[model samples]
Target: MRIIINTGKGGVGKSTISALTSINISKRLKTLLISSDLAHSLSDLFAIKLTANPTRICENLYALEINPIIESAKAWQNLNSYLRELVKNNSLNDIQVEELLLFPGLEDVFSLLKILEIYKEGKYEVLVVDCGPSAETISLLSTGEKLNNLADTLVPLVKRFNSLLGGFIEKKTEVKKPKDIVFDEFVGLAKKLYELEKILMNPEITSVRFVTKASKVISNETFRASTLMNMYGFLTDCVYINMLYPEEIKNSSYDNLYLEERENVDRIEEFYPDKRVFKIYMKANEVIGLKELESLNEEIFSKIYLEEFFTACRTFDIKSEGASKIIEIDFKFASDKEVDVRRIGNDLELSYLNFKRRFKLPDTLSSRKISSYSIEDEKLKIVMDYD
Candidate 1:
């Protein structure tokens, strides 16, 4: 199955593009449109009430607006139930137990795990995801790497506690099994999360598209997001420049605004030459529902070929210049953020602000020392020494 992930900052029209694209593909493929936004963007866009359950939109399309709590409950039922039981046993109320158990972004990451479950079910041929806001999308996509929650820190301790005290406890003791179950469940969740990361990074099966309006403020943010997503190994297949001013806007009172927006559009195209940049002009009437989406379907699908990626390009590359290996990291727009680099064995820990991504060095580079480094334009080039 093919997965198309649409992400952008709030008010960039991601839900619009995600909805229309799903409707167009549903004509032939069994498509599932999933939205994690609590604002009910999908529901409002389609003009149909949707719930955590997938609702039938048309013959081949089904849409679901996820409740993050429901998704977390489904994935972490055992752990959640155990924690609640432990807390309730302490004379805590249900509300108090829930308050303690709920972690910020726990359900958000759980909703992301739901994508892997849906993909494995093999029921739908296509999965269109309306990811959360751009910043949240970055964190959510890195769930596997940054899964250092309470449970994560507690896993090893829990497993060790069970292992140390197991011999003293009776074979039929129920407590031992529960402890083991907690570890097992956490392992299961971690495995699925890693699988989700793998699928998202796979260029052949998944493509991430950025949706943004043609405005300098938003374009600057979009450019930064593109740089960050590349660092995370997610392929930005194309960019959808939504809500452009129509021809009639020329020579009108809004002409200058239109002209400035046009320049932003051209700049975005130039910034992403390898990626197919498509424009969607603002319509005279509000575009909503299936009937209204048919015209937009032609506009988007006629040019965007879903079967293959808009471009298959690697985010980072290594080149042999004489003897040294030059490692280039696409780290533009990241200048605003301070970076701290540390090496642990053969892995490089790239830290910037709150986020840290580990890059495993190749054998050739692992044995060598980083002789020098420089930031040229958008790339961070590192020189590896043969000595």
Candidate 2:
């Protein structure tokens, strides 16, 4: 089982939730907690220095903070060297070319590759990933699809063209062709990405949990992030709203703040009616270390089983009713006014605010026409006709 904890905004106590959840799971199962956030706070939260390598934290728990720079040196040295040579050949200075070696998205790519490797090792029963902020997590989740597409299309073409060019260049010019080792490295990388996609798209094996605080800004961002997660075929089973002031403080000077927080909490509950939403009240002091985290975990999840908490609703399903086919999409937490739907050729385009997704029609529905659509039970059901 893989659990990825993320938040739409910073300072929402995401790492704290991640740490405590791992501790809770490790009590019954062998668990590994990993921080893929560049600005890692897991070390501080656990009060132990962590490196790129896994460090045993307790009896059944281990932790690691991924350092993408070090991982790049290990996994991307050949690709970086090739790009550097190409840049130098174009007359760029060494300093500029060296700076260019640190490619955009390399951190996310290497972090995911490391995750794939660790998950395949089968050493741990459960893997808990403490991802970066929501935006970065969304990008990382979508990376598998993008990389798989490149591997299937671009990488094969590049390999064939490079091989042909190598033979021609060797016969005509003194220029050195790229070595077979470089092409082999790329092939291996592509295979890894393809496997990663399989792991991520399996809803039974992986689920994303969103952590957020009670605020208008954070709530809005969480809604948008949840939509994107659904678009990427990731199951979101729960929303954790953290750091709420205790209700017993009604007579205190912070009454007004509590009132506002209550309103925000109400909005969140309404937004995720289909999801298991957990709320944690703020404590008198900061939460840190295993002892405090264990208490925190109990306060939030004592009533439920961790394994049962991961059971999620399907995002979309296809069913045939008599002569017609129905495609139902679970758009819970979203109103009809907030969503836009259209048909583009053989695909369906769905847009919610700033987020948009295009889904290809299944083979059975590819030749069918969209007879009608309706929003019912917070679900968008589209009817297609065989004729």
Candidate 3:
């Protein structure tokens, strides 16, 4: 399924763009548009009230304003309640316990869990996700890997440490130490976490699209979005340059606005030279309600004949040349930046400017077994074991 996640610096008109994109796409395909941000404006963008559950906004379009606060309670209620008990029993202040309930990872984790459920439903051809800002969005995608790896290594060690501590205390006080309820809760959480990661990294089922402005400050968000997308194998298909001023503007009063748009798009094009860059003209009024959204779509996508709602490049083809396997990585969305390649022990490390990722080698592979590496046809091909 095509998963478009629009995010960047706040007040970039993400909600409006997200709604219009979904509306335009739903015309041709079954689409599910979801808002993952706390300040929900999908309802406002559509000019129709909505609920947390999936609600039909149009013929083939579904919109959901996911209330993470509510979802967090539902998914983690059992665990959170258990945690609260421990905190209260230890004489921790109630306010502190409540604050602890709203942990850093719970919101992101619950949001991901929501996405997984929609993906499993297997109903929509495209899932348009209006995600949180850069940091939260990146955390949502990569947290699965990080959390899984952490739980795998730390849980057992933590359990063992708790056991040792419990035994020592029990012997000194001549009283049985209470069961490690916290550890058991963690183990339970770890299992659920593993499942979440599996679903997120399923390449066949998910992809990410970023909405960005053509400004210098916002460009940093693009760099980070690119770096994170690569780490999680998320194909960032399209980067929408929103609220661009027209080239025909002659008003000196608004010249700076037009100039900035030009420079922003130029900068973005330099960064993502090969990938398609779409520029949406600045509209007069806020894009709310179906009528305004339709007009906005016309103004923005007029050059594209209003055809497909999304733009992307999907190229993941592993070919065998004689005795070697060549895995090609697409860098179409990446500029002509210098790519750094090194062998850090058993992992192959590749980094370019703000982007980097490590690929672990299997037992059959050799460091020198890599026959060659080159960028051709907008793809980076790594040949393994070719004589």
Q: Report the number of the highest-TM-score candidate.
A: 1
**lDDT computed for candidate 2:** 0.78
- Tell me the tens digit of each residue's lDDT in model 2 across 280-361: 8888998877778778878776666554445557877888999999888776557778877777787777776666666567
Return the top candidate by lDDT: 1
Number of colliding residue pairs in each model:
0, 0, 1
Evaluate residue 142 in candidate 2 and report its C-alpha lDDT on the 0 to 100 scale. 68
Q: Looking at model 2, which ten-residue stretch has the lowest summed lDDT?
A: 303-312
lDDT of 1 by residue, 1-387 (tens): 999999988987899989888987887799999997656688888889988888999999999988877677777788887777555547787676766766776767888877988999999999999987887888888887655342456678878877887656636553433557767787778767877888988888988899998888888888878887877778888888998889898899999998888899889988998888888888889888877776778866865545357898887788999988987777776662365556666777666556667756888789887777766787767778866
List where candidate 3 sits over 4 angstroms from the true fold. 88-98, 167-204, 251-253, 302-387
Q: Candidates sorted by lDDT, descending order?
A: 1, 2, 3
Count of clashing pairs, candidate 1: 0
**Winner of 2 and 3 under TM-score:** 2
Per-residue lDDT over 48-116 for candidate 3, one digit per residue giving the tens place of the 0 to 100 score: 888888889879998998877676776666667766655664767866676678777677677777877
